[model samples]
Target: MRQVVISKAGSPDMLRVVDVPLPEPDPGSVRIKSAAIGVNFADLVGRLGLYPDSPKIPYVPGYEVAGTIDAVGSGVDASRLGEPVIALTRFNGYSEALCIPADQAIPRPAKMPVEQAGGFLVSYLTAYASLVVMAGIKPHDRVLIHAAAGGVGLAAVDLCRVYGATIYGTASPAKHDFLRARGVQFPIDYRHQDFEKEVARLSDGRGVQIALDPIGGRSWTKSYRALSPTGRLVINGVTSLTPRARRSLRALLRMALTTPWLRFTPVRLANDNKGVVGVNLGHLWDETALLREWVTQLLAWYDTGRIDIHVDRTFPLAEAAAAHRYLHERRNTGKVVLIP
Candidate 1:
């Protein structure tokens, strides 16, 4: 077997593919012959050493995979062999074959492609947790989604469309048409225009009911201000911290010095009639029952054609570094997967 490891935190070049002994499943676990591995922005953050929760260096960085079960350990059902499934691997998902607890592997929809299944769980789960679970989204609500063309952003757009919410998404000008096609009614060019002003103008100065912000730093302040009274703001990621492929202490210090951290106190919330919350899928691993519930609902939506998973690019496992660079450059409009 082969696995991609982050030898040391630096640039994409730090991702090295090396041969490793094939892993055998322990009791109550199963081995998956990975067909496709999901590439997420968090993986990039892990490689840059910006993610505090990331494991020590010289580790594999992958969260999800879709593949076929070829082996099972003791106490596992032999019938599960040859089953096509999607598994959530907190780490070590970059290998050609890996072992995971059998319960973590969910059966893939019969009609869904393996590539789509590979990228499904994390993005949709994050979006579902933020939009439906946290915000309690309702019909006809005006919503603002930053990075609207990215994986989680697109998943949020699809869910908002299902709930009949009008969407205002921010993206580069090149992805504006793509965002519009994905149900974003107003696509603000974040590079060229002020999204806060655009949201106010587009909503006729009323502002949106919900704002999903993943690009943390000062963007959180703007997203909060773009919200209407009683509106909710969900901060999910801090991509702004790693503006480049390599770690730069100087850049990190500058961001900390320039960005104002808003205090959301009880009085502030009561006076403004607004709410702020955060969602980190990585931290929710222990809430197995909750995750299973959300995954079940999401899979049903996929089966019924209520939502769609868009995969923008697929890279060979050996080109893991290149894959990271692609995501770092913000060139992919949807999920990026790696073939093992």
Candidate 2:
């Protein structure tokens, strides 16, 4: 088998592809012959040593994969062999083949393409956990979504459209048309305009009912301020900390300096009648039941055509470093996947 390893924490060049022995599944686990692999910003953060939860150097980094079950371990159903599925992998998903617990693998919708399925779980599940599970989004409510053309951002847009919310999304002007077609009612050009002001202006000075921000640092503070009196701000990432493809002590120091900006006190929340919540899907690995339930619901939504996964591009597994570079540049408007 071939695997992409983060030989060290640095630039995308640190990602190295090498041949390795195929892994066998443990009891209650199954082996998936990788068809397509999901590339996430977390992988880029891990490659740059910016993610605190990342494993040590020389480890594989990947979050989700879609493939077929070619082997089953003890206690696993032989009937599962040849089943097409999509599974969340803690790591090691960059390999040509991987072993994962059986329950982590969910049956992929027959109509969902292999590349789309590969990119599905992490993006949609993160959106589901934040909007549906946490925010309880209602019809006609105004919502602001940051990075509105990115994977998780588009997923949130689709969900908001289904719930009949008025969406205010922030993206580059180049992507405003794409976002508009995807149901973003108001697309703010973050490159040229202040999203906070735009959200305030577009909502007629009332702000929005919900704000979803993945870019942390001072952006969190701004997103929080863009909310209405009883609005909730849901944060899921800190992409602002990694302004480049490589590690920078200066960026770390800047993040440390801006940490106080995110300090929300109970007294402040009480007085303002607003709320702040954070979500990290990687931290929920132990909660299999909850993840399975969410994945099932997302799959149902896919099956019914209530939502769709947009794949921006596909790269071969060997070009893993290039994939990281592309995503780091933020040129993709949707999911980026790797074919094994």
Candidate 3:
């Protein structure tokens, strides 16, 4: 088997491919012949040695893959042989093959494209946990989403549409038309305009009922200010903490200075009748039942054509370095997949 190994935590050049002996499934596990792998910004953070949940050096760093069952272990059903599936992997998804617990693998809609399935779980599951589990989004509720054209941003846009929410999404001016056609009733160009001001203007100052912000920093306070009374805010990531290209003293100082901006007290939250929740799927590996349920719901949505995901590009496994650069530069409008 072949897999990309993180030679060290630094540049994309540090990621290189190497041959390793094929792995066998442990009891109750299934081996998947990798077809496609999903690349995420979280991968970039891990590669930069910034993610606390990251494994040690010389490790594989992917979270999701989709393929077919090549073998089964004891306690697994023989009928699952050759089954087409998509699964959540701990950190070994950037590989030719992998063994995961049988229950972690879910049936991919036969009609769904393999690349889409490979890139689905991380973004959509996080969105599911945010909207359904945390916010309890309801019909006609005004929702605000930042980075609205990115992978998880697009997923939340579609899911909010299905639930009949009026969406106000923040993105670059270039993405407004693209997002407006999807579900975003209002698209705030973060580079040129103030999202807080625009959102308040659009809502007549009543504010949105639900806000989803994965871009953390000073933006956290802004997103919180855009919330209505009793509204819910879900903070899922902190891309602003690290520079995309390389480490810098200025970037590190900025991160430190912005730290106090995201702080809030439980007393303040309760007094205002507002809610703040954080979701990190990578850190919730032990919450198996919840993960399975979320995956099941997302697959069902895909089967019904209610799940819409755009594949920005696909790179052959050998070109992973180039792919990493693309994501690090934030050039993609949606999912970037790697074909093995």
Model 1, 28-111: lDDT tens digits are 999999999999999999999888999999899999999999999999999999999998888899999999988888888889
The CA lDDT at 93 in model 3 is: 89
Rank by TM-score, descending?
2, 1, 3
Which stretches in model 3 have alpha-carbon errors above 4 Å?
A: none
Q: Please, what are the lDDT tens digits per residue for candidate 2 over residues 1-340?
A: 8999999989999999999988899999999999999999999999998788989887999999999999999999899999999999999999999999999888988899999999999999999999998887898989999999999999999899879999999999999999999999999999899999999888889999899999877788888889999999999998876677888888888777775453689989888899998899999988999999888888878888989899999999999999998998899999999999
Against the reference, the lDDT scores of all candidates come to 0.92, 0.92, 0.87
User: For residues 88-122, could you state the per-residue lDDT of candidate 3 as single tens digits?
Assistant: 89999899999999988888888889999888888
TM-score of each: 0.98, 0.98, 0.96
What lDDT score is found at residue 175 in candidate 2?
96
Task: Give the residue spans of candidate 1 off by over 4 A.
Answer: none
Query: Model 2 off-target regions past 4 Å?
Result: none
Model 2 misses residue 148 by how many Å?
0.5
Candidate 3 pairs with clashing backbones: none
Output the TM-score of candidate 2. Answer: 0.98
